[model samples]
Target: MTHLFSKLSLYNSARYPANAARPLLEIHVLQPRQVFTLAAATALAPVAIDLYLPSSVGMARELGVDAGAAGLAVSVFLFGLAAGQLVIGPLSDRVGRRPTILGGLACFILAAGVASQANSLPVLLTARLFQALGACSVLLSSRAMVSDRLDPPSAARLFSMLSLIGGAAPVLAPIIGALLAELGGWRACFFFMAVFGFTVLTAATVLLPESRSAETSAAARSESPVEAYLTLLKNREFQLYLIAGGANGAAFFTYLGNSASVFQDVYGVSPFAFSIMVALNAGALVWANQINRRLLKQHSLLAVLRMSGRNAGLLAAAFALMALSGVTALPLLLGLVFLMVGSVAPVQANTLASVMGIGRARAGSAGALLGAAIFALGALASSIAGYFYDHTARPLTLVTAVFLAITSLALG
Candidate 1:
């Protein structure tokens, strides 16, 4: 039987003269198809997470639920996403990446359909949970696939790009969802997501080459799953990265959970305008990623961590100060939010990779745990943010600042 995880020849994306030794500054090496598949697969989760943001208010209105109650749908979805990874990661270890991903995609599509037709808040929230459960496969498999095939340096570069692509969805999803909502209402947004999921599912069947082997997976399966997890948990570095990544994940969820209220209710911005703010914030992430790539050429991953940690701490302080100053103006809040997330976003990929670099077999489980911790904490943050959602920016900014500060301390 063929082993799909076997390393392929390095496909160099750059060429230089024999004497040229400087690292290439640009990332044109990932083939068009590789980029597309990775982007689609990895980006699906963020898209699922954010695509409903703009529709949250509409869904609440249509379902006759309060905004806080409707926000439970988002929280439930994230809860499912976090829970799904715990099982899916190990299952992928047993089955293979391709089967895991395909199965998850199928489930996600079904959930989307259910969500589109949901008649009540309970039904919608339930469907969103299932939707999140299915979407986890897409993210886990993509990261696992990269780990299986790419060398460390190449893996870092590709994963950075993957993070960038993943970030783009949140950057644009609110706008996209808002546009759909404006045209045909909240249900129409689900229809759009369903179409996107279906398209990706079809593409995966045709385009995604299998990257893990059944025989190896089967052999590994012979070991006790408990032992496997315990072994990974024993790794000290993995703990560090997990905590670091989880901190940022917490911060991100804080943003997601509070952005709508902060923008519309606190600052009196329109939904369209709020989406623009999200775009700007996400755009900062993209810029940070670019900077991260450049720093890779000159600094070790640890060096990057130190920088990111400090920056996160500084921004968190800024958030706290901003919240206390009673400056709920859109421009002031936007600038602060952008600064806080901008530096934190790019460092996340490196944080995960540093801790999980032992070998490929553990990547899925590790990434899953990392993701689970982040999102689980994020869900907690979301709940807290929502609970404290007075018509002020203080709750949101205070949460962001606190998370960043805590993360910095932990990472430091």
Candidate 2:
């Protein structure tokens, strides 16, 4: 979309390349129509990230890089996610969510195109950084919109739904990524990503409303970003939930950064088998979300968070012990892995809802910081896990266990 023209003058350069003057079709913003759309929009992050998991080894081999460097791609994406949210979240409060997120989607599409053509690891990693920035924009915007419309209870249910939807992305991501990698190689993944980005952008451009109200924009403008960040930082409750979320997020990221390597390299699983295993395990998350939603009826938010944290901690610790014992049986590790991923739902959703409640007035900013904490902590943990890779799952499992303990301590 080129905005050289006024509201009526905007045209999609992607659609009508021969005529830059062609008007883009306007889809009136009927926001209730975007309910599933918004949740789907948030799925792009996992789609972008996990959709390439199976392709990492192929990508590394083609680029003449080692496994660690290839794994660092995930860490790189997390860093960009953290940085992007920190910059875009507060800005959305002032400028409005739609434009900020649309800009991000454009960046994502461009980066995916660049990644498809990248010949070196550096080029690919650079492209991934911008892609994460784009992903965070959608994620932050979608979360802010939820905050705009819902109270804590309702927000939790919606977030649970998001988890249920997002978990499906990983189920599909691995299968598609492996198939694409086999047929057309790793570059195919990026091609798919570019197409996905364009579709999301079009839908968002048409369906997304300006969720940031004029008064909130004015209020946001009253303070500098530094002061706005400081205000949130001074609140201890926000800090507690932020750390809790970050640690839990780190645990998940650690699993992601190393899971492929451990399964494919150590266990000698075929790419096809690996894809099915990942997909089946992902169902745990969907199941967990439904359980979480129901439990919210019987228990308090914090109570759910504590239970999830405790369960996740046990799962991670069990994974580490199994790895240390040289257990390579797919059934044992896969079951443990399923439980670990499942336990992520309540902790992440509840902690996130609690923080958003604390900073609802600054939803954009609060969402940004919370997202940043998760990604930043995740990047650090994943990088650390990648560094210690020893052709075994120990590195990933141990790191997940340590981070989940940190999360459990916060919940305690």
Candidate 3:
């Protein structure tokens, strides 16, 4: 497997000489602490989004807005995430990874502080957007830095490990937010995020080393961002992998957009109970991601992806049927949701590694484009789900099914 990755690396280097140069500090093996730090930094976006989820209803009522209108905060934040990656990916390539991450973290801390003080829906929405922008930098930089350090197979394994580590955020954030909301209202969630961002910023500044070499950074800076992206866009493999990744991501985003309403409003679960259900679902996803990492050692990434894709399609269909039939069984509904969401991990991990392999020289731009496409499609899907919510799970189920089916077809 290492030989295979070495051959692939050689092929990539032969194709993109600019990315072929060795960094000053070559990492033959990664320390556990290093992986944890990078994964924690990358987890910022999920934490920022999920940590305040339990407060959505309370926030809506406090600001005198409808639930659907409050949901637009998520959509706008996703849009900002997409837009930020477009700029930050290239900037990181040019300016180096560490500085860009620190700058973005500073912005994230400031935005979260501002969000805590928001007096209206629009103000909160704007603050969320800025917060997402900052988080996007962390996301892109972490992935790019990993790609810089490892071969494709190793990178894929690292991505899975990161997902496993970061998965705790989705499992824990909502529960924490529920407690905070109970004690101090929605604003408390934002305050917590600000403090969290500050901690990550300090840690990153003190511990994270610059991954991009001076020569490589200088070479990346020589090209215009548009040209860099255009170079990656021309690759056929990148396009297919991007589509696969984006479609899978849309399924998860659709779920995120409506799960709170489905559990709280439709199923009549209390806010605290809803958070527990969400945490359980996230725990299932984390378990599946770990399985994917193990499977990679035995099966090819593409093989795992194909199997997961089929499973996702079948689960999506079942979920849609259950929603349409108005199945009121919470256990069955949550089970289907769990399987469908879990199936995305292998697909996302493999497809992202494949996409990064294609444009190894312009990893930052490649990662940015991939992240942007996922979030852009996700924002669109989530907005559509929110708009057609109708206090039922139909919109969520239908959207998830469509995206999952698309991902299956794309992978096939």
Best by TM-score: 3
Ranking by lDDT: 3, 2, 1
lDDT of 2 by residue, 96-180 (tens): 8888879989999999999999999889999999999988988898888776655566578668877776677878888998999
- For residues 1-412, what per-residue lDDT tens digits would candidate 3 score against the true structure? 3443454456445544675655643443345566677888988988887888888888988999877776777788889988998999889888888888888899899999999999998889899999999999988998888888666766788788889988998899989999999999999999999999998888888778888856557758789999989988888878878888998888888888677777788888888998888788788769988898889889887788788767866876786787678776878878878887788778877887887777777888888998998899899999999989898778888888788888877777
Q: For model 3, what is the error of residue 147's alpha carbon versus the real structure, in angstroms, after optimal superposition?
A: 0.3
lDDT of each: 0.75, 0.80, 0.82
Q: List the residue pairs that clash in candidate 3.
A: none
How displaced is residue 404 in candidate 2, in Å?
Answer: 0.6
lDDT of 1 at 342: 80
Q: Which ten residues in a row have the lowest lDDT in candidate 1?
A: 1-10
Pairs of colliding residues, candidate 2: none
Clashes of each: 0, 0, 0
Selected candidate, larger lDDT, 1 vs 2: 2
Give me the displacement of residue 179 in model 1, in angstroms.
Answer: 1.3
Order the candidate numbers by TM-score, best to worst: 3, 2, 1
What is the alpha-carbon lDDT of model 3 when measured against the actual structure? 0.82
